[model samples]
Target: MEFTITNVILLFAVLLVIAVITTKFSSRLGLPSLVFFIAVGMALNHYIYFDNAYLAQLFGILALIVILFEGGLTTKWCHVRKVLLPSASLATIGVIATTLIIGFFATYILELEWLEGMMFGAIVGSTDAAAIFAVLGNKNIRTKLKATLEAESGSNDPMAIFLTVSFITLIQSHEMNFLSLVLSFFWEMGIGLVLGLLWGKVAVWMINKINLDSSGLYPVLSLALAVLTYSTVSFVHASGLLAVYVMAIFVGNSDLTYRTSIIRFNEGFGWMMHILMFILLGLLVFPNQLVSIAWQGMALALLLMFVARPIGVFLSMMFMKYSFQEKVFISWAGLRGAVPIVLATFPLIAGLEHSQMIFNVVFFVVFTSALFQGATISVLAQKLGFTGETKAPAPYSLELVSIGRTNSEIVEMTIEEGSAVVGKELRELELPEDTLITAIIRGNKIVTPRGTTSLQAGDILYVLVTKAQRETAKQIILEG
Candidate 1:
């Protein structure tokens, strides 16, 4: 027992340290750090490495709860609200269409029974939030694009899980019944949504009701509640992942105390969970199986790239006003990660034929998706003009960050359409004695502001406040 505990501690230390060093090194090379994490897991898998997939899956469930909760907390509701209807529609209709399309194609192409092929399709249909969040979440993408992807990733899993499990039940009985399957899907999804919203509402109330001894402890307490809440919901046959994600979104966006600090803690914890999950997932992959799966997986990925995804997104965006470029980029960014592997388990546990085949195909799909889609989304974003403004690293919590501040500062000076600050000479309203208004950027033009220059309602001023009194001068300038 001592030896086993010691080994666990040692392995964990090694993995954690390696994860930190590797992710930083990989990020410098413009590669997603997740690839490195997976490689390390594959390296560990060499020569037995415990020889059990279930153990890693057990860890996956625990890790996923944390991941889901963190995801919920980090999501911005302001961004999602603008596109909720379209995003929700895409999440539901898109998953169903993608599954059906793939299922029918697989039926003919793989010569499998309709039910079996449908199961295969269902397992891979939903995008993995963990994977998507890890790679795409931090980009300075536009609000609409980011929210659409975020909502889709967060909400689509229940649909996929339902479809996967429903087919598993049918295959076990060697039959398909329309009404029963429909009812089951309806109950699971409805329950998952209702549970997530309710859990989020309760968790918000709890966070507000309790005043912890330390502000720092709030994040820990909230996270624990999130995990427990998730597990409890799932035990009652609800979707814990969905529940926690929704809960986090509410708590994250709400006017709770110490929210800024809590968000930072959750963000850091979320990254660690992502690193651990990818590594565990990678360890479960047998490199030999990947070699055999290479062609089929690559082919399926192409279908995703050229056929299924385009159809899915096209149908999804039917009434939505997304530009063609925006739609195209969305179609291209559907990377896969852990959820498919988890769903693949239904086949194995249900004693379905060729469970190993399902696992192998999923492993391959996730690999291709991460490698191909993950690497290319940025390039396409630029090409499609969806990257809006120039990109910068998202700043951390403690220190405020700004770009191009060497000689200039972008401070928010509120000129309420017709305020005195708006129609005043820079010399008269002139702000601080030292500060200079460099440029007033409105929409996209650089209006050079002089002593007589005035601000506009929708204008954003580029005031060059000195390094000293950058704060005090802005306050005085605005007060003037």
Candidate 2:
């Protein structure tokens, strides 16, 4: 039955309510709510559907845009800079290596044809930044390792998308002309890079130039630009994900008048996207079909976990000074999520043979990744001895004053493992004159202030300080 406009709105309303309830249940069960969201989607498909695959895909794209944009916005330039070289190299090189290495294993061990085996490899190469940020955003891990994971997840998807689409094309045409393939891949990525940077610069200029007084309207404007950037870049055969991410990052880190509102809007949108993507993809999966390939998927997943991911991490970062534990976390951090499954849809839509099998294998890989990696990241972080502070960002505040001319300040502090402030009252700490710990986002909770506030490590503080006494204020906070 076709859903009318009223029905569509009602359906979404019902889904949202269910999402909140399901997430609550999943949290109590020690699981990622994403799994329950997938189950909800499958259940809905049994009794109801959107009546259009295109609609499902449309929602998927919207979700990815929000997810990537939020990631870009939250990504700190300094955090990524420290592990920049390793992270960038891992995203690029590790993606390629995992694909080919797993490809060969599929061909030899699974006794599949070369093309199909490569298809499986290509499907699983990239890590999902959405999943990483969703799970790890709340953890208290070291800054360096977290940066490495976040940056890798943020950048690797485009490369994996490139590889998957490229392999699909090769399978259809039976042509693997090496030079053409290499050139085309580089060209596409190059276009995405150039276009993304260009679009971001232009968008920011327009945003800052147009003095929009309505804080609410500014988020709408930026979001419109984000969608436009994706469409325009993809229409020209560039990476839409790349373009949206860059545009969002530029808009996010810039001095916009309504930066807080914009960030809030995008963050909410990102969550909705995640829920929608997982649910729709889950509906596409047939649990019965997955059983037949159970062993095959398990074997391939084991190879990826035990062999491909770790070797890629160690080899790529051999020159780096990462400890053994950091290396293990790096390997474990290569968790796949909805991106590979989303890419799996490509082969099916194109009517490739064994596409369903490909989809199921992709499903298995993603499932194991989320199940294993998501559950153990915090414990692994502690075990690895890189227990560096990962202070979450403080609550966002909006003000109209010019920060440069005014006496307002931004003070930075690191929370130690055993500081007195760990469980003390903020009032007792005697925070200095006119300084507000405006935001105290522990994990993802933006803590509202009171006299009984207890500080925790990995909590980012956006302190509004006195410009003249900013240095002195930093000393007081850090010392305490």
- TM-scores for every candidate against the unseen true structure: 0.79, 0.79
- Please give the CA lDDT of all the candidate structures: 0.72, 0.75
The pairs that clash in candidate 1 are 72-248, 72-249, 73-248
- Alpha-carbon lDDT of model 1: 0.72
- Point out where model 2 deviates above 4 Å: 1-8, 24-30, 49-55, 108-111, 388-480
Clashes of 2: 10
Candidate 2, 1-480: lDDT as tens digits: 578999889988988888878766654543566767877876776766333444555777787887888888888877888888998788888888888888889887667788878877888888876655455545566778878888888778888888888888888998888898788777777887788888888877776566554445667887888889889888987888877876776666665544566777887877777887888887777676778888888888889988888888888888888888788988987778877877777777777877767777878877877777766665576676756566656445434232554535354355667665676667776766777777665765677766677777766566777555556666666667
The Cα RMSD in angstroms, rounded to one decimal, for candidate 1 relative to the true structure is 8.0
RMSD of each: 8.0, 7.2
TM-score of 1: 0.79
Worst 10 residues of 2 by lDDT: 396-405
Clashing pairs in 2: 390-458, 391-458, 391-459, 391-460, 392-458, 392-459, 392-460, 394-439, 395-439, 395-440
How accurate locally is residue 440 in candidate 1, as Cα lDDT from 0 to 100? 69
